[model samples]
Target: MTGLSTLGRLAPLGAAVAAVAERLRPSVVTIENGSGAGAGVIWSADGLIITNDHVVPGDQARVRLGSQDVVPARVVGRDRLNDLAALRVPREGLPAAEVGDSRALRPGQLVLAMGHPLGLSHALTLGIVSALPTDDDERELIRADLALAPGNSGGPMVDAAGRVVGINAMVASPGLALAVPSHVVADFVTHIGEPAPWLGITALPVVLPPDLRRRVGVAAGLMITAVERGGPAEAAGLLPGDVIVAIAEEPVRHPRHLLEALARTPAGGDLDLVILRGGQGHRLRVAPARRAPQADVPPARSAA
Candidate 1:
């Protein structure tokens, strides 16, 4: 009798979840690349698909529509900074997912994670918004407790109202699923097919120890893990293992801050950077250059 009552109480909630899944199923798609397959969401009725840059590693990928139609899709744009990429397929009258403001999301709010996880087609998982990245993070990644798998990399995280709020991007340790907020996705779509300035470096944000923090006069800094040869960063004398503490007098604590500071410098213009190398500080001026096409240059890996 108690089990029957508990089942009765959960029936409405189960039905509501099922309804949302059915509503967003058509807009979700399977994106297959040379590496593997992931999920993507249709962002426009004219066949614009939004996915993760990691999902579509190269310039093009194969998109499988809901009707089981496989078509070759071109990479319209990829913003490696935010881990979001857009694709264009030759089709019309497609179902577009309704995007919602991620800023409006509250902690503990019910959300649905839709994706094709572990080769399973059209999988739906439930969870709540665990946390939102602080302003300093810049990427606006949404942290949720949703169960995610390898194939869920580029799917949509929809709200109870069936509005897409974020795109599943990566999962962190200790069971946290991260997604790129919809607002960031919208910005990437706005500048689709446009290339941004590139400062060829692979960096990771690191927190300095108490003594080092006091010595560097900052709490955090970006550790230059890799400096591209013949690139602007290398030209500026930025070597691997150097810790960048500031840019043009502004303290840079994260990769986003460094990127924003670098974006302010025009092509061929100098950006004064303060780097701590070997327990000493050195100021180096770096000039950023316009990024080349996907075929010409390697993408700088900075997201961490």
Candidate 2:
């Protein structure tokens, strides 16, 4: 391919990629915390953003808009299991990114990653979807060959049409970058601000004794270290030393597993929990109540 011939062949593709990058640039923001900084995608016009849970690890973060103006943002919610987090900025009328359906993505489809990689803002990398990994429950993930770095975490991965299909999570290897699918991001944002069921208890994962494991038919369980005063757990006669074996028939091994089960439980709905207290396994029905909103500072600043 001669240089002139190559230019003629590649110019159109280059122009398309540039257009997509331009459209997505304004919707991508820099998310900074005490430790470091990453990228975030504007998820709503009213300043709701989505980023990686690790990027916004603290209770608050500082979001820098395209104008280089920084604003304080509160952490609305985090789903560490899915490695996604939501933030509420103290502003509105922000330009949210155009989200597309990841389920419609196909291997070898052209995509672009827009974010700050190696602290370079508005960096764009082009690649094709290498694979799509699905979990047992049909949760999908995008695996691309895009070059990404630390600062690319939480950035938007948009298709050639400039529609976001996923959020760049991490570089799995030299050239493979993994992204949390867009459908999961949409679901996370929808429930992040809503009041879900709450069973007030602090617990940790614990290995069951051999005999106890046999009795509970599990290798591990969550040990309730503390039951909140006047909370649903206490109301259900759950003691601090109780070990949770299952919830709604699903096996509970990790603390997050229990949390996922609780999140699916409807407010004011009965939850059947199988627990082992004092080496005695028993089942209890508890009605989970709506979670009380935390006393966090409201969104008060404006930068839009």
Candidate 3:
């Protein structure tokens, strides 16, 4: 009788999950470039689709909608730094995923991911938010304990309420997946063609010593390896070998976090940076410059 009661209680939850998956199926899409295939999310009813920049390497591809309709899609904008790309299909009144506040997400909360994994169409996977950005770490990616395959690169990672919270990005390890938070997606979508703010510096993540960590109140920092000549960073007196701990009051443990903070700041606006030089902490102000007019080049991987 106890077992029967437990099953009865689970029946409703299973039904609810099924219902959510059904509703999301229409918003998830299959993207196919000449070399390979991936998944995407219908970001708008007017045919704007969101996927990983790695998924669509070319200017054009094919999008398969829920209605089994296949249409040509043009790559509208690509942010290789964030690994996000926007595509536009020639369709309207499409079912679009409801955006959710990824900042509101908490660890251990339930999440559902939809994708066409391993050529399987519209597959659903269940998991929980393994972790979120922390003040000391400030990674822009959402870490989830979900199984993600190659084909899952750009599908929607929705909550139990069927609201899109993230885009399935990549598998970090076995049973661990990473996602680009929906808030980041919203920002990327809003400024599709605009030049991303640039801070001309190359840096790399470095672990701070215990004494430095205690003094600086940060676990790690990005060590500046090079500063572009005549750029904002160099003009601000930033030198190589300096370790940057925070940007505009936001802790940035990764280059992506720094880039995201720069993206939020207006062009030519003053930016406050907290850094350590020779094991001593100091604050400096710099203005981010605009990227030169060119094709979307990947941000310097060493650090930007």
Candidate 4:
């Protein structure tokens, strides 16, 4: 009798939790069109944080502090194929996030979502790891049931240990979120000593299909969809119809798989391309010429 129906009993507890969460949120400072604004998060401290490439797409993208302070962020590097980007702020003596290994993560493991949802500022949501999608990059990603919004792009997803396991990067409407797993991210940061071109490719994972599972065939790799004329593929004699089965003997699937193979292949060095054409396979070794530039989005932007 004392409980005032279901709705009335839930209001106060909800308000208390919201209050605490608001205070704990971090800020993601976005600099666009030469203007700066705040985006919130759970980790405000410093070092380097991984975020969506679009968050800092241009020559400049910096993060803001909880106290409304701004820090200049530069492109540490980015993986366009995966839509994952990493930026570093030069704020030393700031709080850095603790990196957690996602390898040990199990399905339904407790996880928290932190970001600038809907561009509103810093926000946090609770959920559990629903799945880990293995993209062609040979990296395992975090998939969760927590609600993620637009502004929350590039925030940290921490676990009970207060260590970051993923970066809040994408959402599938309503309440699905996907993150770049921390393990791959950590290696990226430690090794990203230089910037690399983003060869937009739909790298498919090279897993033998059921029919070919036991045949000891080529590992699935990026099947060349459309090659930019005069681009690397064209210069190297890679055709649009070519199925890039591997690079330097490593199996590849369509899209990023081939590019990854190509990227690791030194520029100007003799590269071996193993492709399937006309249901038959061929291996060609050739020097990789510089890939020519592409046209800007037609009708979207004229030649500048």
Candidate 5:
């Protein structure tokens, strides 16, 4: 979407993005729970702030609203599988990014990504969807070629309507960027009250040596790089090195398949994780945990 595309779809988009960023962006504090501080967008009013799960792994990350006020956020819920997470912000009625329909998303549709790229907080980037699902799971993807930087994790991607379409997740060497589709985010947010860390791990193309693929007799499929520490998979003893071969008995041909599996499951439920580790297969039943908000303050503040 054009920076103004969201403006085109929804008039007063400039005002809307501004307001949403003011409200939702404030709720999106920079996280330093080991993943480093970056931007996140508020998805709901009752403190359900959406961000990339990797940012706030622990319950003690810092949530700095607008300006410089920092607070402590606890883990309220998490979806490590889908890479979408919720954090609680102390301030109420924060501006929130509008959620748009990912199903209606068309390739080459104008899209925009807003986040802290290159450690520059609140920077905005533009790009097109570039591709779409071809019988593959749609809920798990938000592929684009827009510019992205390391610090842009957990930011929002908006449609012309200024509605959020995806959440920043990964970028490959060729500048291909991937995000969690808003619909997939909706599914995760819908089931946040679970007792365990229940998420479906999919295969990700981690940079394993080419020889590893040949030895494993697999060409290309998402590999399970790491599970959330002490999360449903961890609590269930699911290890980081394990590769997810399938979900619900369906072969996980790609990373997005894991997204489909997690979207289909309920919070507080057990998932049968089929994994390939050391060339051996195993099944593990895991329950996911609820995502949490981080509470922290800058060790020091500065004025530039």
Candidate 6:
């Protein structure tokens, strides 16, 4: 019968989903930080875990492993802007999640989310990729039409193959969730201890004139307001009032875009800056310096 045939075809899919969930449960962990509990993903065999910054705001927390074994975890690094934190546990040979290329993901792709929802452990949810970052978007987030709860933050969003493509960060709205892309997490892990690169300039977003916009191929850019004395921008002969159109070929339409581009560049690396001054487009090569550690100074509105 038609109904029987449909059920027969769906049986394999249901079995496959079960198998993937079983395989990935070991990599998902429950993190308790006194405020509440959330989930974390085992990122390495040597006990490196990744979770949301808000989950582990302090330097220490407890991680409940798949075996129900509770262990002490240390917050090794935190990137609050991206809402991601890296934790190290005193354990070895853990089952690590397979990281997938989020850049390869397309809208409508089937995805799975695993977490501890509402005190229930190892809960799984089904969903699909709803959208991706656009040129005007400020942050790189994976938007999903997935059901997520308070306890789902810091969990892994995997593809059908059980490879992690994103880290669930927050619920955007009803029936909508936003996740930090896996590629961005990889970059954060790579530069965990390194100081963020500094451009030594303050800037604000400004709309480009119609003729300049058509010529530059962008509608808006960051206008440099001040150049630090004897800094990279000064050394590169960059003056205030210059509009930054792009950095290393990546368009800069807002201050956040400039900050994101600078974060991607390594300290002491050469930056290819495309700028406009006096209605003329120019390219400048500036070597960014590593920002020195400072106290709780408020982040400047500029790119640095």
Per-residue alpha-carbon lDDT of candidate 6 for residues 1-304, written as tens digits (9 for 90 to 100): 9999999999998998999999999999999999999999999999899999889968999999999999999988877667889999999999999999999999999899999989989899988999997767666899999899988999999999999999999998988999999999998898777777876888877899898888768788889999999888999989999999988888888666876777767655788999999988899999888864222212235547
The Cα error of candidate 3 at residue 256, in Å, is 3.0
Cα lDDT tens digits, model 4, 1-304, are 5666776887875675565455345333443314433232323355465676666657566566665677677765665545456566777555555668888788888787666555565666888888876644343468888887767676777775656788776786577788877775665565465434333322333455555444547656545555555444565676655566766776664444444454565555665777777656788665545433222222111110
In model 2, the runs with Cα more than 4 Å from the true position are 1-16, 32-35, 56-62, 67-85, 89-92, 102-111, 127-145, 171-178, 205-223, 240-243, 276-281, 292-304
| Model 6, total clashes | 0
Residue 251's lDDT within candidate 1 is 82
Clash numbers, per candidate: 0, 0, 0, 30, 32, 0
What are the TM-scores, per candidate, against the unseen true structure?
0.77, 0.72, 0.86, 0.67, 0.61, 0.85
Off by over 4 Å in 5: 1-28, 134-139, 195-304
Segments of candidate 4 deviating more than 4 angstroms: 1-49, 135-140, 193-221, 225-240, 247-250, 262-273, 285-304
TM-score for candidate 3, please give it. 0.86
Q: Give the C-alpha miss distance for residue 74 in model 1, angstroms.
A: 1.6
- In model 2, the Cα lDDT at residue 159 comes to 91
Q: Write the per-residue lDDT of candidate 5 for residues 1-304, one digit (tens) a residue.
A: 5876755776665565565454445534466566567667777766567788777767656766656677666656766556666787676676666789887899988777777766677776667888765634423666888788877888888876668888888785456788888887887787676432334232354433577656655444446555655555666776656776666667665544554555456765656767677766678776655443222211111000
Deviation from truth (RMSD, Å), model 4: 6.9
What C-alpha lDDT does candidate 5 achieve relative to the native structure?
Answer: 0.65
**RMSD, every candidate, angstroms:** 4.2, 6.5, 2.9, 6.9, 9.6, 3.1
15: Cα error in model 2, Å: 5.1
Better of 2 and 3 by lDDT: 3
lDDT score, candidate 3, position 134: 64
CA-lDDT, candidates in order: 0.84, 0.82, 0.87, 0.59, 0.65, 0.88
Native-to-model Cα distance after best TM-score fit, residue 241 in candidate 3, in Å: 2.8
Model 6 weakest 10-residue run by lDDT: 292-301
Q: What order do candidates take by lDDT, descending?
A: 6, 3, 1, 2, 5, 4
Model 6, residue pairs in steric clash:
none
